[model samples]
Target: MLHDAMWDDEFPHDPTICYLNHAAVAPWPKRAADAVSAFARENIHQGARDYPRWIQLEHRLRGQLQSLLNAPGKGDIALVKNTSEALSLVAMGLDWTEGDEVLISDQEFPSNRIPWQALEGRGVTVRQVNLDASDPEAALIAAMGPATRLLSISSVQYASGLRMDLERLGRACRERNILFCVDAIQSLGALPFDVQAIDCDFAMADGHKWLLGPEGLGVFYCRREARDRLKLTQFGWHMVEAMGDYDREDWTPASTARRFEPGSPNTLAQHALSASLELLLEVGIQRIQEALQQRTAYLLQSISSIPGARILSPSAPERRAGIVTFTISGCPNAWLFQQLKDGGIVCAERGGGIRWSPHFYTSQQVLDNALAILRNALQHYNRSR
Candidate 1:
C-alpha cells in the first residue's frame, strides 16, 4: 500500500495553504481523520457496546509508542494529556529537598521550564544553562553542581531548532547520578529516538506536532527502574493494580508507568493517534528524517539566495532538524509573518524570525511557492522602506 502511485493521499492539505509549520500543530493524516470519524460513529450509534475493541486499540497504541521510542516495553509507556502534564508528573512526583536544583537550557519552551520554575517556593532552584556555545552538552555538564538533582532538556530547542546531543548529556548525567529528562515533542516523530540509547530517565512528547495526530494526547516514557523513585501525585481507579475492582478497600498504584495516569483514558484520541503512528511506523523514521533533511536543505539554499535574508538556524545539517528559521534584514518579523500569512504561506514567527517547518511528505511545489511568497514579501518590504 505504501508503494501506491499517489502516496500523498495520506496528507491531503488544502491547496490554498502552503503548510510549513509542522513544528507547531499539524494537520492529521487522512487515515487518522478517518479513524476519528469511525470512532465517533461507533460512539453515536453503538455507545461503546464493543468496548473491548476500544481497549484493544488502546493496547496497540501503547505498543506503537513503545516501539517508536524503542522503549523496553509497553509497560514503560503512559498516555498523558500533553507534554506539560507529563513534565508536571515528573516535577511534582520527585521528592525534592529544599536545596535541590534542576538544570535546563535557557532556550527551552515554557513546557520544559515552567514546571521546574514552579518549584521555587520549595527552595528548588531551576538553573538555566546557556546552549549557544559550540558544545552545548559540555556547557550543561559544567553547570551541574552538587545540588543539581535532575537535568531536563529538550531534544530539540523549540524556537532555535538546535538539536542536542542527548547521548552525551545522558552519559554525563549517568556519571553524575543526576536524573535525565527529555522534552521530545519536537524530535519524536521527526527524527529517530531511542530511550535506551539516550538513557533518559523520563521522556515525553505531544501527538499533535511531528506525530501528525490530534491534540490532547501524548506519550510519556519512564525508565522501569526509576518508576518507583518518584512519588505518585494523583490517584484514581484506572491507576491501581486491580483497576476494575472498584470495591476493593486496599489499593496501590500499578507497578508499571501507568501509575502516572490517574483517570479515564482518552480513547477517542487513541483511535486517531494510533492510525497516525501506524502510518509513521510503516514509512519508518529514517525515511522521514531523510525527507525532512532534504526539505530543510532546499529551504536553506533558497533562502540564502534572497537578498537580506539571514538564516538564524544552524548551518550544519547535524545541528538542526525540521525547523529552518530566518529573518529579512529590513522587514519587521511581525510584518513578514503577516505577509506570509496573507500569501497563504503557513509558517510561524519564532526564534527572532520567521520559522518554517516542513514534514516528510511536504511537496516540492509547496516549498517553491512559499519561498516565492517570502521573496515577494521581502521585495515589497524593501521597496516601501
Candidate 2:
C-alpha cells in the first residue's frame, strides 16, 4: 500500500498567509528549513571535520533526483547551478550549422528561449511553435523540417497552464530523429516525470520552485548515450575524473553527466534541496498528484461561480496541474494582481491574467479564504465601473 502521505499538520509559524504560487518560488517546508539551520550551525561548530558527510549528502541528492526524473541511472544526473546554467550547457554544447533550426513553444519562458536565440551567431535559426492553437501537437510537429536539429519544449507551459502531451512529442521526435530537450522547471516536482517515457535527451529544473528548496542549485539530466554527443563548452578542474588531484597533468571530461558540472557543487543548496525532496518523497508523488488535482478542481469551481471572472487555465483535469489562472472581465490584470498581493494572497500574473498555484500541502480553508478574497476583489472591480 502507498504510505498515508497527507502530512500537512500546519507549519509552525503565523500560518495566516496563503501561498498559492509554487510555480514561482515556493515556501520551504519546515523540515527543509531545519535541515539548513542545522547544517549552518554545524559549519560554525565542527568546521570541515564532517565536510565529507556533506559530499555524501550531495551524492544522495543525485540519487533522489535520479528517481525524480526516472532516469536510467544516477550517472545521468549533473549538479548545475540553476535551470539557466543547465540550459546554457546544452545551448553552447550543441554542434550547430548555418540554417540548422531549433524549435520551441511560443509561450516559452525566457530561460528556454533566449539560449536558443543566442545560436543566431552560429547562423542557426530558432522557431517558436504556437501552443495556443487548436492542435498544438500538430502545430509543433509540422514546424519541424529537414533542417530541424532539435525540438526543445517546456513539459508544462510557464504561463497559461498548458500541459503538453510529452509522450506524443517524444514519439514524433523519435520518428524524425530530432533531439528532444525538456525544460522541466515547471513540472518536475509538481508531477511525475520520466526521461525514458518522454524519450528526451535532456531535462532540467531548479530547486526553488516546486522542489520547494533554495535557489543556486538545480538538476540536469543527460542521457548516458548523449553525454559525449554534446560539445563541452565549459571546462574546469572539478569536472574531471581526477577532480581533487590538482597535480594531474592529463585529464578528460567525465564520461558521466558530471562533464556538465564544471566546478564544485553547491553544498548549501544541496542540503536544503535534499531536505525538500525527502518531504515530497515521504508524501509520495502519487498522493501529491491527487491532492493537486483536487485543489485545482476546487479552484476552478470557485472561480467559475463568480460572474465576471474568466479562468484561463484548462478546465480539464488532465490538462491542468497545480496552476489556475483567471481574469476579471473589466479589471486590469496588474490591478487584480496588486489587490491580491496587498490582500496577502500570493500568486502571480501570467498569460495576461492572474495565476494561482497552490501546493498539495495547502488547505481547503486557505483556498476558500483566497477565493473569498478573489470574489471581494472582483466585486470591487465590478462596482468601480
Candidate 3:
C-alpha cells in the first residue's frame, strides 16, 4: 500500500485551502496537468502530426477504464462527454412501452432522476423509492412490479453518502429480468466498483469528481449481451465500423460500446484522463478505498463529538463512502457553509446540511484545520445566539 508521503508530489494543492470537495469537482493531480500541458505544446508545434499517438492514448484510457470497472472487455466501454450524455443515450435509446416502469431512489442526483422521468412522455412510469427504510435494497426490490422494466440507481447517494447493496439489487433484477443501470459518478473513483460482480447491465461515471480528470470526459459501460437491447439513438462517422473509410457509401455502427459515441473524440481531455487513471491504477483501487474510508471514519467520529453536530450521512462503515454530511444545532446551514468557505475549508452545501468529502490524499493537517474552523464558527454562532 502506498503511503501519503509517496503520493504527496502528485497533489500539490494550495496550502491555505482545506479541500474536502472530491464529491464535487476534484483537483487534478500533477501528472494529469503535466499530460495536458505536454499535449497542448505538441498541438501547437505539430497539429495532427502526432494524431496517431493520441489515438493510442485514447485506446489505453479505455483499457484503464475497463480495469477500473472490471468489465468483461475494453469493447464494453464507451467514452462519452459526461455521465449525463451517457445516461441520455441509455434513456433515449431504449424502447419504452406504455406501461413500463423505471425504479429509482428518491435521493438520486438530478442527472440520474431526470432521464427516467423524461420517459414518462412515452407512457413509462418512474417510481422513486424512499431509501430511509431498514432495508433499502429490499424496499427497492419489493417495489418492482410486473411492469418494472429497469432499475436505475446510484451506487452511492450523492447527499447522504448511503452506499447501496448493488450486488443484492443486481441479483434481484436478474431474477426478475429487469435491466440494471448504475449512475456511479459519486462512487467510481472513491470506491472499488465491479460491473461483473454487481451484474449491472449498464454503468456511467464522470471523470471530474473522483477520477481526478477534466470535466468533459466520462465513462459508460454497457454489458456485451445487453448492448443490442437499446436501439441506436445517435450516429456519425466515428461511431461506424469503418470509421476511417469516409468515402464508403455504406456503413454500420460499431458492434461495441463505441456505437454510443456519435461524433469526433475529445482527444485533449482523453490525454489528461488517461494520465489520471494511471495514478489511480498505480496506487490500486483497494488501497484508495481503504485510505478514503479512514478519512470518512475520522470525520464521522470527530463530527459526532461536536455538541450539536447531526450527521446526515450513514454512520456504518459498510454503508458509507467518501462523503460526510452534517448540520449543527441552532446554526443555519447557509451561515455555516459561508463560514467554512471563508475559512478556506472547501465543501458543498447539500442534503440540507454542509457536506465534507475527503479523498485518499487528503492530509491530517487539512482535516484538523477544517475541524478547527468549524469549532470556532460554532462557538461564535453560540455567542451570537
Highest-lDDT candidate: 3
Worst 10 residues of 1 by lDDT: 1-10
> What clash pairs does model 2 have?
none
Candidate 1 lDDT, 87-152, residue by residue in tens: 999999889899999999999999999999999999999999998899998999999999999999
Error of 3 at 88 (Å): 1.0
lDDT of the candidates, in the order given: 0.92, 0.87, 0.93
Clashes in model 3: which pairs?
none
Residue 167 lDDT, candidate 3, scale 0-100 = 98
lDDT of 1 at 381: 79
lDDT (C-alpha) at residue 202 in model 1: 99
Q: Which tens-of-lDDT digit does each residue in 51-73 have in candidate 3?
A: 88988888999999999999989
CA deviation > 4 Å runs, candidate 3:
1-3
For candidate 2, lDDT tens digit of each residue in 1-385? 1113245542432445778989989988888888889989998998879978988897899999999999998889999998988988888987778999999999999999999999998999999988877779899999989999999999888887788889999999999999999999988888988999999999999999989999999999998877887899888986888778899899998888888888777887888899999988887777787888888888898898888778888888778888899997878999999988888898999989999998878877788889888878878877887
Clashes of each: 0, 0, 0
Candidate no. 2 TM-score: 0.97
> What are the runs in model 2 whose C-alpha is more than 4 Å off?
1-6, 13-15
